[model samples]
Target: MLKTAYTLLPALLGMFLLNGCDSSCCMDVPPASNNGLQAPTPVITLDGQPLQGNLTCDPTTNQTITLTAASSDPDGRVVENIWKVDGVESGSVVVCPAPGESKQICLIAVDNDNLENQTCVTLTANNTQPQEPQATPPLPVLTKGDVDGDGGGLYLQCDNTHDTDSLHLYPEDGPFLYGSNDPKDIKEITYNYTYYKADGTIESGPITTTQTEFNEANDQAPGICKKWFHTNNGVATIKVVMTALDDDRQTNTKTYIYNVADGLLVEQP
Candidate 1:
């Protein structure tokens, strides 16, 4: 084997010399490396504004936000951009979601060098809801005038049959009976009646009679009712508090003041 290899070596050297073999004939040099190349960083902007930390859409618009991003390879390579919303590819705009819905958006840009630069922008979907109107104090209307001219106490009575009735005032007559039931069959507010007199004192009446519905009526708006009373002929201030019947958990109160001259509320005194 050694003799054969030695004999072939001279022949091979002669052939190479005759063929004019140069340094290029024996080996191949590797191509240039790409390690020196850099992966670009994409510049991301939303609504023409540079992104800073987490981004939120303008609350007033409640609409989609326009996205515009740019990337360069420094090698002057062409760059391609990809946008996504909640991981789904989309257009240059990010759309808002239905009321109470929220989502995210992302963008990825790649250069022609096969090098990729990724930048992601987030868009939070928002649904604004209208504010509810607040409940206000009840409005009350008074039919009868001030206290009686003659010294007289107030009278209040309830009639269940009516459920709601417009209690009328006398034609400048004298005071009616206290808790009067002249016409008969009128139920009074048993346990819930409370009054504040002009004398600056408070009174609670466990009247202990049948209670009439304190529902919405013409005298007062819904969820309100009024109680009439005959008070001192000198002076009387009456206050009525009505509770809301529904889930609103509201209370309404109103006060009435009058002067008494004789036995009735004073009209001219």
Candidate 2:
């Protein structure tokens, strides 16, 4: 007829421009969008219990296991809740994990449309280690030339201006009292004296001397003294601390500084 209708109108206009419209003309599609953004669902708990896979805990009750971080945003509202453990950022969702140690433990979840989401858990700790407490052994160190032994010359025997001076301490290996009669070898020798008065005003006590334990005749009596009253010849210092208290109260101090010259007793270098 008009040359077969002009060859079927260019093959039916090339099938309506390559099928953009075929059985009766139709085109209208705009339905796949994600602009509403939703991604944030991370949760990990412990005291309330839901973790369900790997967790061993119990650091021998040396206590510390809190972990509760949460989050969930189907459309938006989970501003941030991130805690990690082996990857290292956890100042507070608490997880000690060190006795046998195996930590993975994560929680991320960020969305306000910034969209983040994480969740992990491994945490193992409990190989029986927790018993560390035994440290208290250090108290025995007395050496000031073993208590000032040859600078000894307290010649104020009666009274040159004031009196009292029987300061002689002797310990050349005699009286750390381990003599084995064992009440822990019984020791308690304390002598304290501190009188620095040359118008500086200071006087101290403690020297009744029962001299326990090592009695080499209690070192011939008259052990620690200082009761002076001599103003202006100006030399009155006598510190002397000597302490030795064993039987587990464990102590051993020795400090000396003597300079009382009106009749003499020097020792101070």
Candidate 3:
């Protein structure tokens, strides 16, 4: 029996070695595996130049920029590449910030094994001159007339009768009017008249005047010799472009069009 047992021990040891088991234990263990997966590496480029770190751009010239990425994986294939601007995924087309602004740009490369790598850079827009506020156009008031050609604009009654009308254009005074919240004093006003003749010809002329003089003339009586539109031609279309300039050289211009029909002058939209 002892000889049989010794012979069986050597056979058991051989079985353990063949099954990849340690000599201390007789249980079978699988060999360690290495799939050799690797994370992707992303290389970012801005306008065909390699992006190493932060970048500064001019708002006037570099309003828009193109971003791209080249990604690779050592042991696997890169399946996707994503670009993000200001932490939002915005693809490759990046809208540069306004003057005195900054944005974050990032690139992410993903491998087939769900492994990813990211690279980011900061982009700042250079500061520029402070922009001036836009001037507001003047507002026009139209009132119906009591007599022939009497009211603010040309008055058209229920019978389509033509009458003198009053049309007054007021400069911007407050936010409720045509101007900004902070009202600016109007320094000058100019009127450019364009008459569209029925014969398909156009006549244009610039009427230059100061605001003080215009107010003195137009603001006299409610309807006496006001700055109203009138035509001696049978029927025509007239366009009056009124430009108002503030004290800071900011200007706002508006066009008022009037159409004459059946001897009645009517303002068009």
Point to the candidate with the largest TM-score.
1
Q: Over the full model, what C-alpha lDDT does candidate 2 score relative to the true structure?
A: 0.53
**Deviation from native of the Cα of residue 98 in model 2, angstroms:** 10
Question: Once model 2 is optimally superposed onto the true structure by TM-score, how far is the C-alpha of residue 137 displaced, in angstroms?
Answer: 16
Query: What is the Å distance of residue 188 in model 2 from its true position?
Result: 2.1
Please say which candidate is ahead in lDDT: 1 or 3: 3
Question: What ranking emerges by TM-score with the best candidate at the front?
Answer: 1, 3, 2
- Residue 49 lDDT in candidate 1: 69
The best candidate in terms of lDDT: 3
**Model 1 over residues 8-106: C-alpha lDDT tens digits?**
999999876556545676357332234456666677786666787655554445577777886556865646877778788888776666555666766
Runs with alpha carbons beyond 4 Å of true place in candidate 1? 1-40, 47-49, 57-63, 77-79, 96-102, 112-115, 124-246, 258-269
With candidate 2 superimposed using the best TM-score fit, by how many Å does residue 96's alpha carbon deviate from the native? 3.8
lDDT of 2 at 237: 66
Work out the TM-score per prediction. 0.43, 0.25, 0.39
Cα lDDT tens digits, model 3, 120-216, are 9888888884565443443332232333355323421111111111212343432121222334234445666666677757744444443333233
lDDT of 3: 0.57
Indicate whether candidate 2 or candidate 3 has the larger lDDT: 3
lDDT (0 to 1) per candidate:
0.47, 0.53, 0.57
